[model samples]
Target chain A: MTYDWTLWIVFILIGLATTLPRGSFIILGERASLPEGLQKALRYAPAAALAAIVVPDVVLVGGVVEVLNPKLAAAFAAVLATQVSRNPWLPFIVGMGVLLGLRHFL
Target chain B: MSPSFREGAREGFRVFLPLSVGLIPWALVTGMTMGGVGFTPLQAMGMNVIVFAGTAQLGTLPLIAAGSPVWLIVVTAFVLNLRFIIFSAALARGFHGVPRAERWLAGHLLTDGVFATCLEKMLSHEDPRWRLGYYLAPSLWSWLLWQVFAFCGVMAAGSIPKSWSLEFMATIALIVLLVPMARLRPMLLAALTGGTLAVLLRGMPLRLGVIVAIIGGIAAGFAAERWQGAAR
Candidate 1:
């Protein structure tokens, strides 16, 4: 329960985090001109950040990097599944299936 | 609620519904993963509804779990959502001379999908009223789906099996989002270099490797873009 306050504070701060940037232009669109270099960096940051997050989750098991892991195999399988289907859920479905199947068998 | 605004809003909802439907899986997964983080279901709901950012909300969870400094959590979320700056700027520029209220509201509602949809539609023929209505209408529809689905997930979270590791679904979803971007050379470089560095630096305390990876990835991508430009 002690963490409740912290969580609440986070909610408010996050709300600002989202609203502020999104509204940055509306409030100052006429005067605000993001640098061309900044824009390019922003374009690539999300993919990179997502990659960072996803890499550790799948490649590392309990902190140490493990070669033989269900998550790792599932990730590769997910890439293949996505290539084959236009279905939005195909990657998740195939990846999870592989993960569970491998976990059960191995 | 002028006739023009109402008509535009109707069209907007029709246009954005298909994309909003795609958000369902992501919304539910976010809710479930949030619940699995040991927060109460109410807290989970609050995070989704109040923050109203899927990526930032999910990205900040590790910091919250680790009991990282409050400032760090806020800064991380802000960095994670930096794309909104580009999105909002482009969106706002197109709405030149729109009413102040509508402009502000549109900015608040400027989501990734909404920004893209708004840009694709030629709303300039219509007045600011219609444009504002069009933006608000679809956003309302999307927000409703986000809340309803996320709420359902949080409620059902208790009965969900823990051993299944449903939280991993968030990672898988992110992977799905990332894979298509790999087709772009600069993006591929960023992801590969960033992801590898993250693994190498995973030992960073308070999960600070994420921030480092993001910066490194952006630098690599910038360098790649400049290199490609020079080569051409």
Candidate 2:
């Protein structure tokens, strides 16, 4: 298959842009501190963004909310695993197991 | 184990273990899906190793499969990963004394999970070395597992069936991981704002909705913090 230079360029640009933020603050050193308020905001950004992505996906399947969806069931299992194991991997596994198992039933 | 190596290994292990659990299925699915879409195992693995961000990688898969322009794929991935900038800066503060080589290594290891775990550890611990280890441990595990799963998924691409329900499961996994972090009011606000904006703007092309959501969340969070500080 022919390699797409356009894709390669796009990927490189993306890589640079993605790396810039992470690298910028490091490169900047102590020249400036992130604004105190902005710092506070950053704390919640991940969770909120993630929730936005996850909630709808779990609750709404095929443009309809299905309370009995296995995805939600596995998600519940993951929450349990996270609480019980206090380990990140466990919840993910439990969730995956729930998903696979439920796949058979669905 | 010497203290240094022991710390490194421990840090590596913490990141490696749990991350493996989440990554295995995700990577496998990615690989399998890539194959289903016509990418070879080597190509899929290459993407995993090279791109290294799960969401962005997944986001670009369909585009790649559809023979979308390379620039579009790269641009989409870049926008999705812009948050790492904030994470890296926050982490750099904690690793001021780390050598350049170690810093680079740490950068490679840095991801959402490692950043969160390390941030918690840094807040609680004073030992730089231990802090480093604590941060590194889970990230290392996550990284290693991602590679293993990606490779396995690519190899077994044909065997793994696609289930739309599993997609929901993935979202749930992300939600479970995110809930504990929404502690502060500003954080809650940021999450709410970002998420709402994302949904509202989901129709925008090239995943620009995510970018808008991020900006909205950050701005809301900043305003909330400033207001709280003034009130105090």
Chain A of model 2 scored by TM-score: 0.76
Question: Candidate 1 on B107-137: residue-level lDDT in tens?
Answer: 6667778878877563364476667667889
Q: After superposition, how far is residue B133 of candidate 1 from its true place, in Å?
A: 1.0
Best by TM-score: 1
lDDT of 2 by residue, B1-232 (tens): 3386467557656554654565666676666555656555666666677667776666556556546556655655664565676777676666765556666666655677667656755556666577667666676677788888878767775565655332333354455546675667877787778767766676677666656776787788778878998999
DockQ score for model 2: 0.32
RMSD of 1: 2.3
lDDT of 1: 0.79
lDDT of 1 by residue, A13-95 (tens): 98898878888876675777888878988998778888887788788888899978999999888888879997877887788
